[model samples]
Target: MHDAPLLPVSRRQMLATSGAGFGMLGLASVLDQNSVHAAAPVAPAVSVATANPLAAKAPHHTPKAKRVIFLFMNGGPSHVDTFDPKPELAKQAGKKGPGGKWMPTPFKFANQGQSGI
Candidate 1:
């Protein structure tokens, strides 16, 4: 027979009741240690907005342009149409590629600008 006395509450209930006390006990020990170490004077609080580099600031000079045009082409232009114009692919248009049959762009890529880039 078990010699231990049975409580009115279940094991789960006992644990739930004592859990907060155990947490507070641990917190008290931490606070006591912090109090001893934190004898040094605290620094003055600085404005976070002013300190932040990304914070918006007034322009140094008066702006000439009132409106801004932002062309956000998600994929921009295709690599085949812009930079890499594969002449061999044009010759073998209906040939098999690495991933199934190669589909070439119908439009002709011209040398653009002085740099031609």
Candidate 2:
């Protein structure tokens, strides 16, 4: 009975669940592709008033943000040590590290001229 329980709940369960998930996902993808092929081709647009689902529209209200600056680091930055200041960031302060784990910066910060394009 001991070996029976162990065998029944062993690697086979994990493999079966994962295999079934992938199989269902594949089947769904095939069905979606088939349905797309079965769908009728949309008629060519005739007028500017012809509504396009993806067309841009005027906002209901004034936009809060006009410009956005996205500074994407090659790797993730330490939130606490960089922008987000925390009271308990002493452990993460001044520790130089790499990868996705917790890390700290080793560079000096100083005020410079206005930032622009």
- In TM-score terms, candidate 2 sits at 0.27
Candidate 1 structure quality by residue, lDDT tens digits, 1-95: 87999758989899999999999999998897689666665674875466886878778999999899998878777764666667787887888
Q: Whole-model Cα lDDT per candidate?
A: 0.79, 0.64
Error of 1 at 21 (Å): 28
**Number of the top candidate by lDDT?**
1
Best by TM-score: 1
In model 1, state the lDDT of residue 28: 91
After superposing candidate 2 on the true structure, give the runs of residues whose Cα lies further than 4 Å from its correct spot. Answer: 1-30, 33-37, 44-50, 53-104, 114-117
Q: Model 1 segments beyond 4 Å from truth? A: 1-45, 56-83
Q: Which residue pairs come into collision in candidate 1? A: none
**Cα distance off (Å), candidate 2, residue 30:** 6.9
